[model samples]
Structures are given as structure tokens and as C-alpha cells.
Target: MLIGGGHSHVAVLRRFGMRPMAGVRLTLISRQAETPYSGMLPGVIAGHYTRGEAHIDLRPLARFAGARTIVDEAVGLDPRARQVLFATRPPIGFDVLSINVGSTPDVSVPGAEGAVTPVKPIDRLLERWRAVEARLLASDSPCTVAVVGGGAGGVELLLAIEWRVRHQLAAAGRGAGHIRYGLFTDSAHVLPTHHARVRRAFARTLAERGITVHAGSAVVKVEPGCLHTADGRSHRVDEVFWTTQARAAAWLRDSGLSVDDRGFVRVGDTLESVSHPGIFAAGDVAAVDPHPRPKSGVFAVRQGRPLTENLRAALAGRARRGFRPQRRFLSLISTGDQHAVASRGPFALEGRWVWRWKDRIDRAFMRQYTELPPMRAAAPDAAPADEMAAPGQVPDASMRCGGCGSKVGASVLDRVLTRVKQPAAGRVVIGLDAADDAAVAEVPPGRLLVQTVDFFRELVSDPWVFGQIAASHALGDLHAMGARPATALAIVTVPYGIESKMEETLTHLLAGAVAVFDREGVVLAGGHTSEGAELALGFAVSGDVAPDGVLRKGGLRPGDCLILTKPLGTGTLFAADMRGRARGRWIDEAVASMLLSNGPAAAAFIAHGVSACTDVTGFGLAGHALEMARASGVGVELDLSALPLLPGADETLRQGLVSSLHSQNARAADAIANAARHAGDLRFAALFDPQTAGGLLAGVSCAGAEGCVAQLRAAGYPSAAIVGRVTPGEDGERWRLKIGD
Candidate 1:
């Protein structure tokens, strides 16, 4: 498992992409979907490069590398359990782990965290930079911006910010003369790590720009609008940006890993943790004890290949190799305009040509990830040998038993259940706590019991997220019938692995389901677990509804308007995602839509006097809508253009990417009168794109339809819209659906 989408990890992903290892399931856990290329950050700040050009999207990269990515921050590490803990999800196990989570600027000063914005974590910095530009553009008064730190990063960042802000103001027809700049550092000179000549050149440029330099002054305290230095000097500033020395994440030291005084993981020449085996560290988060080097992107980029080799060696149980970082390397620092300075030890050069050269180098490095070649399927005969837990580390698949032997071990199952926070007993009588063979639930008086079952193999690699989606999907049926969910019984099939691995996977999956159930006030009763070739999950959900309040698909009237509670196109988007053709943001939006429970929308529909209701699920919109229409004994006219679509849906459909069941669902288009005429349209194609955990489709009177949609949107179903209208049908209407403009 890779912990961060840092500079080194991106390289590691690229290498693994070019030549993937068989049987080694790679997973990347990152805080953000995209990680900025530090080398091009100053260029972006200076308006020389677009943000997209300076950032690498880890989703496509991870998929191309045959790796699953979990977009989350790692909060802690359980060395004993070999698991990585997350704040919002259950812990995930990793056989071999690597850490490349880069550092943030040291914000140790009093009140600094609240007053000064650190210039690391370039994504957040860029967001703040945009705000700073907007604030300056709108201000008519003089504004003083202070930068703390004397190193190359601080100097370059300050100049870049100044240039961008000034340019923006000029474009807005505002005077930039009111803007002032100040640089403070404990070091006696700027570019403290650079050659003396380079420092002198920058100092001269700063003076020419009228920027004040407070050398040998350390910021002791920072207030909202003022800062105090160690030398008893106070400087009033509008905003303060920090670009100080890097600091490690606090969890590293707490994880019992050997760390330096500053909390950075200590590693040897091989980049492996000195205190722990099977764990590696790199990037700014790691301090090489054998040969200490300054924390810089260049070093991290250089360590990528060595880290990959060592990690692969460790995983394969081969002898590990050592890597010694170079003592000196070339540095190219841009001056926020079209010029830059190049320095290598005592050698220094300054010219616009230097900036062009640096730009070329940076873009080339980024292209390795952004301009990846199309992935090809492996040949049958050329497939690499399975490396799943070495040769004899686990029981052979053929030798494994069947029947009751396939069930998960009792102790492992118990441990997982003990840790999982099951939903509170609301309607459940004999639940998990009772350890009964069958779960028993009680139905409240005057309410009828409603039950539905759903099961599917993992579409997503993260068990935690998949669990949530699966549970939400099963519950979608209950909501469609206008029922309040009361209880759920899980059915889990875990891939064969060691006892501990099985426990961790089951725990994560259950925890995710329980999180959704608890939020919806549904109890998780007893369930079953069994070994399988692939991970799968399902739930038998039970709900309660008043007999008079239950909504059905056959209640639609001729004048009713059809309302869809969410967007379509999860099918095409995820299919494209599997092939690395979809963007990260698109998948993110799709996941958000899937996680949105249809319960609120269902309640809103019922409140608005909805006549009929059904959820858009695996059968696609066309099939489900046809089912509703046929059952209501009426025809329907759907507005092709009115259908809401998820992001990137059209692009994927146009590329002929779709879920495997799309063809089967498309057969329902025969029920549409204009199927042939609109066969080529992407929107028409979307009608047949199967969805997972999708929205609610309902029929409401014309007057109440608009109000019902309004209520749904206010309740968080923003895409809810009237997509069609029910029409009067004859006794034998062969084609009951028609597409409208």
C-alpha cells in the first residue's frame, strides 16, 4: 500500500504501470485525488502554468498501474495489526507499506496556525492564493503581505504570489502601487541553502522591487493583523504566508516508528525504516539517517526508482538493495516572471532561457503521468506468476475445503463483530448481540413489514465504500415503497486470505454498512460470512410502512408527471473508470450521488402525494420506467433532453464505454416508439445505462410535481426533475413509451 500521492509515489505508480506485478494487489490511500507537482508550483502561482498542468491526477495513474486507490487521509498506523487507520472509515490491512506523504511548513509560532497559511500542501495553498488575489483586486487600500522563511521556497513563492496578484489587479484596472511586501527569516540571507552569488542576485532583485528584508528576525508570534519578531519588532500585516522548514505528520512518531526530533521517519540508505521491516519511507516525510539531505522535490523524485526496487524486493522476499542519494544536484529557481536562476554548487547562471529550460524539464516530468499510454490487457501465456503471499505462505486454493469449511473462522468473525459498532436495537428483537441463528424483527402496530434483498460483487476496490453503496442500494427498495427502514442482515463473501486479513476486510465492510444503517436508524442483525474467490456483500433489509401509505408502481394516472430524484450515468462513468478513461472528479461526483440515500426523496414524494414510485437501479431508467408504465396500464412520454446526467457521462457513452449489462437493458428501448430515430443520440443511449444505488422515479399530479421536486431538491436531491408525463393507453398498446424533444 502507498500512503500518499506525493512526488515519489507518482513515479512508483508509473513504473508499476509500465510493468505490473502479478498477484500483487496495489492500493494507494491519498488525502487528495490530485497532487501538485512541486517543481511547477511556482510557475502556477506566477500564472505561467494552469493548475491542471501543475497537478497530477492520481486516479487515472492508480488505475493504469492496476492499483486501487482510496481517497482518504491516514490518521494512524497499527504496526501490530499491519493496518492503516482512517478517521472516517475502518482500518485497512497492508502487507507491505510505503509512506511518501510530504511535509507541511513548520507552524510552531504562537497563534501561527490561525494567522499564517502554510505554503506547503500546494493544493490548499493554491486555493488560498486565488482568494488572496481576489481580495487584493477588490481592495482600494494599501495591503501588506508578509512572507516568513528565507529559503528558496519562501523567496520563490512570495515573488510568484506578488506577480500574480499584481497582474490580476492590473487586468482589473486597479493600481497595484498600494501593495507592499515584507520578508522575514531567522537566517541572515535569502536562499540560505544556495550559493552566495545566487543569494546576492536575489537580494539585489528584491531591493529593485522595493521589498523589505528582515534578515536574522524570527517570527515569535502572529496575530490576526500583526506579527511580533524575536528582536522586539512588530510588523502589522494583512496576511502572512509560511514557507518554513518542513514538519512531519504527528502520527508518525505516535505509530512507534523511530523518528527524528522533528517527527520525520528515520530511514537508512535503502529507504527502509530503520526500526521496522516491511515498511518504507520517502519524500519530505523521511529523513535519511545515513546521508541527510535537504527536504526538496528533487530528492524525492530521485528516490522513486530505488524505493520501487526495494519495495518490490521486500514483497518478493528477495535481498534488498541500498540507495545513496547524490551529494549535490542542480537547482532551477524561477523568479516569478519569465526569468530564472540556475545553480549547481558554486556555479550560477541567470537568464530568461533558464526559465524556459526549467519549464521544459517540469512539463516533461509531468507528462510521464498525464500523457500515459493506453493500457493493454496481459496475454494469457505471458501472465506473471502469482505473488499472493509468496509460495507456501498460505493454503493452496485446490487444497481448501468446501461446504462448512468455506465459512469464516468463528474467532475471526467474533473479533470483527466485537469491533464493529452495530446499529442500535430499534425494531430488532434477536439481533447480533443475541447471536441467534435467525434474526427476528418486530413490526410496529398498524405498519406492514417490507423486505428486499440485494447482492453484488465489488464494483469498487475499497471494501468500506463498497459496503456503504451495497447497503444503500438494498435500502433503496424499501424507500421506493415509501417504507421506513428498520433492520438489515448482511451477507458477506470475502476473498480467501489469512485469518487476520479476513478479519480486517470483514470489519471494514461491516463498519461501512453500519455507518449507513446507524444514520438511517436501521438495526444490523445477525449475518453470515463465507470464503470466496472475490469480495462480495449484500443485505436483507426490512422496513415498516402504513398500509395506506405504501406507494406502488401501478398507481400512476394519465395526467401524472414523472419525476426522477437523481442523475443517471453511473454505469458508463464507472465502466470508463475501470479502464482509466474517466477523470477523478467525475468518479467523485458519481460516488457522492450513489451514497445519497433515496429515503429523503421518497419521503418528500409521499408528502407531496406521489401516485407511483420506483428506484432507477441495475435495470436502467428505460426498463424500470417501462415496468412502472406497463403496471399502471398507461403510456409515457419521456423528455430525452430533460434527463439529468452525471458528469462525464456523455463523454464515456460517446466513447462506446458502458456497463456489461447495458446491452440487456437496451432491449427495453423496444418499448419506446422513437427508439430507431434516437438510437444514435447519447442521451438516448443513457436511458439504457444501468445505475447502482441510483435515484427515485415517481409520478405526481402536475400541480404537485413541481412542488414535489422542489421539496426533493431542498432535501438534498438537487438533480430531481420532471422527466416525462404519463399518457392514456389503449387496451393493446405495443409501444407504450415515446421520446420527446
Candidate 2:
């Protein structure tokens, strides 16, 4: 498993994707969906490169690698337990692990932590940059900005900021004369680590830009509107940017690894942790014990290949190779304009051509991951391990070819499906519906049986959580028909493992499902079990309802209010989760939302006089809602903004996260009015995100919509809200989905 979306880890994922090791499962857990390429950060600040150009999208990369990317940040590691603990969720087990989590800025100075923004964690820095730019644009009076480091990172950042501010002011018909910039460092000279010629060139450039260089004293403290230096002097500035030091994350030290004083993992020449076998470390978060090198992107980028090779070998118990660092490497330091300085082992040059060279080199490096080779679709919603399935063609490639692949240890269903007998004529109380979970029977005195089945490959690694979600999902059609759950038959798949291990896994998986079954007062009937390559579960459920009481999708009135009893974006968020790009909290919240039962929400709708209702599932809100609309012969206008969303759903959509089933779901966009007008909006894109075990989307009377929402919220669904209203379009205009943002 790869812990972090660092440069080396991306390389590892890409290589494995091209040549996957059969029977070896890989997983990547990261805090964010994208990892910034530090090489072009200055150019980004100077507006020379867009944010996309400066960051690597890990989602597609993980897909190409065929790796399950868990979007969670590591908090600690239990080497003995062979597990990595997350901030949320239970600890994930890994046979082998590698750490490439990059370092952050050492923002330890007084007031700096809260007031000043650091240059590291480029994502946050860019956000702060936007705020700074906005404040500058609105300020009528002169404003001062200070950078707290005089090293390469700080110097380059300061120059970039100055250039960007000046150009922005000029663009707005204002002047840069009112803006003041300062560079603070404890050192006596700028670019102290660079050669004399390089330092002189930057110094002259800074002087020309009218930026003050405060070299002798450091920024001892950062204040709200100024900075305090060590020399008993305070420099008043509107914004102070910290970029002085690179500090390793404290979590690494607590992970029980052999870390240096700065909390970075100490590694051998092979980039493997010195104290931990089968655990590797790379990038700024690792300190090489054989030959310690300063924290720089140069070393990090070069470590990728060696780290990948060594990790593969170590995992397979092969002899590992060592990485030899280059004594001197070329450095292309941009001048914040269309020019740069190149330095290597006392040799230096400067010009616009140098900047072009740097841009080419950076883009070329990014292209390795950005312009990746085509990979098979890694659909998160594809029948994971046979927990659930849909009839006919699977748009997702992952679910295809499940003939023999679908079979388990024995011919469990052959006897039942193939064994046919002559019908007992009128006495045949129940007719055979082999496809249905349970057959409908002719009962006396107005009675009917409702049967439904649900299964899908497991989404989460936790079997227990998967069990609950799968069982809850089995009630989708039953709840849609306003039927009460009665009994269920489970079909489970366990990976080929030891007898004890298999039993334990099955126990946890069934226990979780049974607990939920008991809550809904459903019985656990006999089911089938088999061994497979991965963990999966499925359930065939039967519920009961009156013949005339079955809620049909066609029951809708023009004036009915549409109520959505949950948020959207599970499909996209989980898709993002598989790319290791979704936030942990976002996944956690999405899981919690999925576990929510629509039984209560459906009851609430029925109590308030339901018109038409259906639980949103794999087809997504737009697809399922359109189904309801078409079935009811009505038009619907959804207030795009009013559609309740899970936390980070909008952000994930904006970040370009869409599920494998998104294309299929989005195929229904034609049913939407003004689709093109809102195509660029992230909220509109969410309409295509597939949901699993999602909330109930119901059409109810306008008079009862408010009270229905209140009852649903009070019943534990705070996210439930009235999203749209039914319209009068059954035939001529067809079904229409109007979006209001």
C-alpha cells in the first residue's frame, strides 16, 4: 500500500498500472486528490502556469494503476499489527507499506501559525493567494506584503508575488507604486546556498523591482498587520508569507518508524525505512542515512524510479537496489517574468530562453503522470465482488466477464434454477419467478408478496460497513413500493484464505448485516456462501404490502412538491475515494449518509400523502428522478442550489471527480432543461453522480412538503429538503428537468 500521493508514489502507481503483478492487490491512501508539483509553483504564483499544470491528478493515475485508492490521510502505523490507522475509519491492513508523504513548512514562530500562510501545501497556499489578490484589488490605500524566507523557495515566491501584483494592478488600470514588498531572513545574503553569480543576478533583479531585502534578521514573530524581526524592529505589512523551512509531519514520528529529529523517516540507500522492513520512504518526508541531502524537489523527483524498483523487490522478497544521489544537478530558478537563471556546480546562466527550457522540462516531467497511457476503467460502482448486480450489459468494464468468474466454490444455484417440475395447476399457490428474490403467491383475502434483491461488489474495505450498506440497499425496491421488509437470504463471497481467517471475515460481515436486519425486524433466512478472489455480499429480500397499497412511480400530481431526503454526490465522492483524492471526512460523511435507511423517510412521505417516491441508487438523482418524472408524466424544476449536498461534494465535483457510472447516468442530461447553460457549473455535474443506498426522492402534496421535511429531519435526516416541484408536462412537452442555481 502507498501512503501519500507524493512524486515517488505516483511513479510506483504508474509503473504497476503498466505491468500489474497478478494476485497482488495495491491500495493508495492520500489526503487529497491531487499532489502539487513543486517545480512549477513559482510559475503558478506568477500566473505563468495554471493550477492544473502545477498539480498531478491522482484519480486517473490510480485508475490507470488498477489500484484501490482510499482517500484518507495516515495518522499512525502499527508495524506489528500490519495496519495503517486513519483519522476516521478503522485501521487498514497492509502486507507491505511505503511512505511518500511530503513535508510542510515549519510555521512555529509566534502568531505565524494562525496569521501567516506558508508556501508549502501548495493547495492551501493557492487559496491564500486568491485572498491576497482579492484584498489587494479592493484596497484603495497603499498595502505592504512581506515574505518570511530568503532561501530559494521564499526568494522565488516573493519575486513571483511581486510580478503578479504589479501585472494585476496594471491590468486593472492601477499602478504598482502603492504596493511595497519585503523579503526577511535571518541570513546575511539572499540565495545563500546558490553560487555567487546566481545570487548577484537575483539581487540586481530584486533591486530593479523595488523590493527591500532584509537579510540580517529573521521574522521572529508574525502579527496581524505587521512582522517582528529579531533586531528589535517591526515591519508593518498587510500580509506576511512564510516559506523559511520545510518541516516533516509529526505523524511520521508517532508512526513507530525510525525518524530523524525533524520527524522525517530515516531511510537506507534503497529508500527503505532503516527500522522497518518492507516499508519504504521517499520525497521530502524521508532522510537518507547513507548520505543525507537537503530537502529539495530535485532529490524527490530523482528518487521515484529507484523507490519504485526497490519497493517491488522488497515486497516480493527480492534483493533491493540502492539509489545514488547526483552530486550536482541543474537548477532552473525563474525570475517571476519570462526569464530564468540556470545554475549547476558554480556554473550559472540567465535569460528568457532559460525560462522556456525550465517550462519545457517541468511540463515534460508532469506529462509522465498527466499524459498517462490509457487504462481499463476502474469503476467504483461496478459489482465489487458480487455483492449486487444488474441484468444485461454492464457499462463498466469491471463487471464484465463474470460467467465462470461469477461462480464460487460449488454449483450453488444450478440445482434450483435448472430443476423444473410440472406446475400443480390451480393449486400452484405461488408461481415461479426465478429472477425475483421471492415468487408472488395467490393469497386469500387481498394480500400480495413483494420480493427484491440487491448485491454489489464491496465498496469499502471494511466488510462490516459493507455488510450494513449492502443489506440496507436490498430494501431499495421494497421501500420504493412502500412494502415492509420481512425476510432476507444472503449470498456471500470470501477471499481464498485460511479457515480461521475466512470464518472471522464471514462472521463480521454477517453480524453487521444481521444487526441491521434485527432493527428492521427482518428474518435471516438460509443463504449461500462461497470462496472467491475478493470480499463481496448479496441479499435477496422479501417484504409484504397490501395489493392496492403498493406505491407506484406513476402516482404524481402537477402541484406536488418534490422532497429529497438526503444529499447527493456519493458516486462521485466514492469514485474520488478510489483515486485516493477524496478527503477522508468526505468519505466518512458519505458512508454515514449511505447507511441511512429510507424506511423512515418513506413512512414520513406516506404519512404526509405521497404522490410518487423512489429511493435514489446506482442510477443517480437525475436518472432516478427522471424515471419518476417520466413515469408520472410530469415536469420537474430542481433548484440546483437547494439540492442538499454532502460536505465536499461540490469541491470534489469541481476537482473533476466523476464515477465510472457517471457517463451512463449523465446520458439522461437531455431530460434536463438548460443543460448546456449549467454544464460548466459543478452543481450541475453532480446530477450525474451515482448514489448507493441514497435518500428517498419523493413527490408529495405542496401543503405537506414542509411538514414532511420537518418530520424527516426530526427523524434524523437533517440533510432532507424540498428540492423541486412537479409541473404540468405529461405528453406534449415530455418529461423536463429544469435546473435553478
Candidate 3:
């Protein structure tokens, strides 16, 4: 599993993509889908590079490497068990692990964390930068901005913000005279680590740009609108950006690995953790023990190739290779207005041509990730479009919809619901076409009512796919309780756009949902719709169950075998998808499984006379299984390896990708009996992998467990597996799991 989408990890992914090991599977876990190239960040702020131009999209890179992309943050590590813990998911096990999570900026000064924005984790910093830009453009009054630190980063960012603001004003026929820019440093001179000549060049440039240089002024504290220096000077400003000291994630210090006082992982010359074999650290997060270096993107970039080779060798049980960074390297720092300064040791030069050289190198580096070999299947024919509205013609949501007129247009609703004909069952005495406020249902003499409601914001980028998954997921509740689905009431919220486009999108979505409804023989009664910020869908589904026959979670008995009807890992995969970290094929496969109804699986369980069941959803397998185990007053001995998994799940888990709900689900670890003993096994991570329209988890009689699994496979659930068995439990027994025992 590869953690962090930092420079070295990207190199590792690209190499692994080009050449695959016969039996090795790779997973890339990243906190963000796109990592901003540190080299181009200043250029981006200066408005020379667009967001796309400056970012490396780890999604395609991970896919190209045949790796599963998981978007999440690593929280801690258990070296003895070989498992990496996350803030929001179950611990991920790995035979080998590498971290390149990069360093965060220090915000240690009182109120600094809240008052001033730090610079590393460039994605968030970029977001704040845009807001500052907008505020500057929107304001009629003058503003002052301060950048703390005399380092190269502080200097470049200050200049870039100034340059971009000036150009924007000039473009709008306004001059930049209204804005004041300042740079404060604790040291006597800026570019504290660079050649004297280079510092002189920037000092001259800042003076020329009319920027105030606050030399030897250390910012000791920050307030909402200003900062105070250690010398007792208070500088009031509209915005304060802190870039003084580099800091590492606290999780590193907590991760049972050797780390420097700053919390950066301590590593050997080879970049492997000095104390933990099979686990490696790189980029700013890794502090070389013998030869420590200041954190720089250039050094991280240089580490990529060697990191890849060493990782491959270690994975294949070969001798590791040594990669020592050069003692000196070229530095081309942009001055924010298309000019740059070049420094090599004591030699330094400044010119526009230097900027061009730097730009060429940066763009060339970006191309490696952006220009990937396409892998999607042949494109389908385009859907016919209604004439699009001209720019700015899309209606503002607030302008419409306080009354009945705000509802979806009757004609459009009619067109969309034409496919949702009522089922021929007598349970529906009055249906959708009747146009009543609500539909009437008849409960059979021996049946009890079961109702469930579910709704969510769109997951997939595609509307049709989103609709299908929503509908299927809503019905999963009934399937878990062994109820026969009967009808549904849909509540939809569609974004305000061109009338024709909105209608078309809604039609596709409803059609997709109706297809599933038709298969399950469920009728779409009626519901409401409204204009909203984004498209969202939900359902209040009603099903039937015989009171005596209903499957409650508390029905499990000792000696019953546990059967999981489908695979795990939908949560992390979808979370990755939301960030564009997951691959298309991975999503396609997940959707296919999601759309595969739990109807048949429910029936298979019912046929085997099993009453203990629950569908694994956002809480993950471990969570739902624990629910069943605890409620039934029994313990579950899960054979971790026997659990079925969706394609890319294990890979994504290894890469540290997990859903936002992963942490909550992982909390169920308190219920696992033997987790710590075998927590390092990568397969165990699947337990906390959340599912969308996931499979059924049930306890069947030991005598019928194998037969029930056979029946489920015969019913089209080929991935179904007998994963565990219910065991005796004392009120206070400790472990409830036996993973890879």
C-alpha cells in the first residue's frame, strides 16, 4: 500500500503502471485527488497556470499503474501488527507500506492556527488564496496582506499574490495602488538559506514592487485581523499567511515509528524507516538520520526514482538500493510576474529567460501525469440535447418555488414517470396516475408492514448511475429484514438549470430508478420535488413481512455459520470516486454489483430458514456484523480471508483509501475479539470497508450453511461466501473475531 500522493509516491505509481509485477497489487491512498505541484504553485497564484495545469491527478495515475486509488488521511500506525490506522476507517494491513504524506506548516504561535492560514497542504492553501483574491477584487477599500517568514516560500507566495492582484486590477482598468503588501521575517534577510546574491535579487525586486520588508521581525502571535511580533510591534492586516516553520502530522509521532522532534519519520539513507522494516518513508515526512536535509519539493522529486526502485526490490525480496540526494542542486524561483532567479551554490542569475526555463521544466513534469494512456471502453452515442440556455440565462433557484408553481413541471413529470407504471398487484388500490396526495396500500391478512427511508446527495458524476444506486440502496433495508418490497415514494431535488437540460437529466435519473423498481416489482407511488443547489434523491420504501418470519438482527444462535452474500469495499471506492481518485472501471464494476439486487440473496437466506440478518451499508462489515452479534447475545468468529471483496477493494484498502464513514465504522473495532493479534494482515482491512447497496450478512444453521451459499451462487451471487459462524458469548467476553487464525 502506498500512502500519500506526494512526489515520490507519484513516481512509484507511474513506474508500477508501466511495468506490473505478476502477483503484486498496488493501492494509492491520497488525502486529495489532485496534488498541487510545488514548483507551479507560485505560478498558479500569479495566474500564469490554471488549476488543472498545476496539479497531478492521482486518479488516472493510480489507474494507469493498475492500482486502486483511495482518498483518505492516515491517522496512526501499528508497526508490530503491520497495520496503518486512519482517522475514519479500520486499520489497513500491508505486507509493505510507504508514506510520502508531506509536511504541514507550523501554526504553533498563539491563535496562529485559526488566525493565519499556513501554506503546505497546498490544496487548502490554494482554496484560501482564491477567497483572498475574490475579497480583494470585490472590495472598494484598500487592504494590507502580510506573509510571515523570510524563507524562499514566503517570498515567492507574497510576490505571486501581489502580481496576480495587480494584473487583475489592471485588466479591470484599476491600479494596484490601493493594496499594501508586506513580508516579515525573524531573520535579518529574506531567502535565509539561499545565496547572498539571490537574496539581494529578491530584496531589490520586492523594493521595486513597492512591498515593505519587515526584517528581523518575528511574529509571535496572531489575531483575527493582525499579528504581533516578538519585538512588541503589532502589524494590522486584512490577511495573514503563516509560512515560518515546517511541521509534520501528529499521527506520525503517534504511529509507533521513530520520528524527529518535529514529528517527521526518521529514516535511513535508503529512505526505509530505520526502526521498522517493510515500512518506508519519503518526501518531507521522512527525515534522513545520517544526512538530514531541509524540506524541499526538488529533493522530494529527486527521491521518486530511487524510492520506486527500492520499494520494488523490497516487495520482491531483493537487495535494497541506496539513493542519496546531491549535496547541491539548481534552484529557479519565480518572482510572480513572469521573471525568475536562478541560484547554484554561490552563483546566482535573474532574468525572464530563467522563468521560461523553470516553466518548461514544470510543464514537462505535469505532462507525465496529465497525459495518460486512455483505458475506458468505446464511447457510447451521445444523447440528444435540448437547446441549451445562453450563458447567465439559467434561473436562480431562489427566484422560484415557494408554492405549487415551484414543483417540477407537470408535463416534465408526466414525461419522466411514464416508465413507472404501477405494478399489477392489488396492494395498490390507488396509484400515481390517480394524482392523489398519497397512494393507498392494502396489507395482506398475515403480513406486517416494514418501512425504510433513505436519501443522499449524488455519488457518481453520471445522473443515471446515481439514480439506480439510490433506488437499489433504499431497498437493501427490506432485503436485510427478509421483507418483500412492494412500493416506494421518491423525493427528488434537482438543480436549477436550463429547463430542457434539467428535464432531460431528471428523465434519465427516474428511468434508471424505475428499471430497478420494475425488476423488484415495486411501484413508484408519488412524492415531491423542488429546486435545490444540487441534484439529490431519496425514497420511502414500503415492504411486507410475516411477523413470525421477519429476520431481526437478534435472531442469531450459537453454531450458526455466517454468510456474506456480496463483496466489501464500496465506501472507500466511492469516496475515491467523489475526489476523482477512483478509476472508471473500478466504479463501473462497483455499480454493477450495487445494482445487483439483494432480493435474491434475501430469498436465499429466507429459504434456508435463517432469521438473523443485516445488510452491510455505511457502517462497514465489522460494524454491521457486530450489531448482529451483540444483539443476538452471541459472538462471531469471522474468517477474515473468506470474506468476499469487490474488485479494487483490497487494493484501495492497502493504499489507505476509505470512506468518510470509515472512521465511525472502524470504531466498531471495540467489538472485535482478536483484531489486535492479526491487525496487520491486509485482508483484515476489508472488514471496515463500507458498502453502498452491499450484500447481506446472515447466520445460517451449521447444517445448511454450505447449501445456502450454493443456492446464493446459483442465484447469481458468485462472490457469495461463508465467511464466519456464530459462537457462544458471555456478557463480558473480550474477542469476537478470529481473523486468519
TM-score of each: 0.95, 0.73, 0.57
The C-alpha lDDT values of all candidates are 0.88, 0.79, 0.81
Q: Which scores better on TM-score, 2 or 3?
A: 2
TM-score of 3: 0.57
Q: Mind giving the per-residue lDDT tens digits that candidate 3 earns over 1-741? A: 898999989888887766666445566777776787899999989989998788887776776676755666777888887876766333555668999999878889898877787897787789899999999988769899999887888999999999999989889988888899999999999998888899999989999998999999988888888888989999889898878879899878887799998999999888999989878989899998887888998888888988888888887788888777888889999899999999889999989999999999999998888776554331111111111334466655566766667688888788666644554564777778676777888888889999999888877644666778999999999999888999888888886666655665686567678778888988777778766766799889999999987888888888899999988878878766554456545776788899999999989998998959999888888888888877887888888778787787777777887888787777777777677886776667778877888999998998999999999999999999999878786557623544537
Decide which is better by lDDT, 1 or 3. 1
lDDT for model 2: 0.79
Top lDDT prediction, candidate number: 1
lDDT of 1 by residue, 1-741 (tens): 999999899999988888777667788999888898988888888899999888898998998888878989999998777889999887888889999999999999998996788987777788888898778888789999989998888888888877888788788787688999999999999988889999988998888776899999999999889989999999999988999888999999999999999999999988999999999999999999988999999999999999999888987888888888888899998889878999889989999999999989998998899888897775111222234665676687667787889888899888898888574479888888877789888999999999999999887777888889998999999999999999998899988766666787899889889889988999889788898777899999999999999989888899899999999999999999877888888888898899999989988887888999999999999999999998888988899999999989999999999999999999998788878999999999999999999999999999888888889889998898999999896556522888976
Model 2 ranges off by over 4 Å: 376-453, 459-492, 497-530, 538-554, 561-610, 618-691, 701-741
Cα lDDT of candidate 3 equals 0.81
Clashing pairs in 1: none
Q: By lDDT, is 2 or 3 better? A: 3
Cα-based lDDT at residue 124, candidate 3: 75
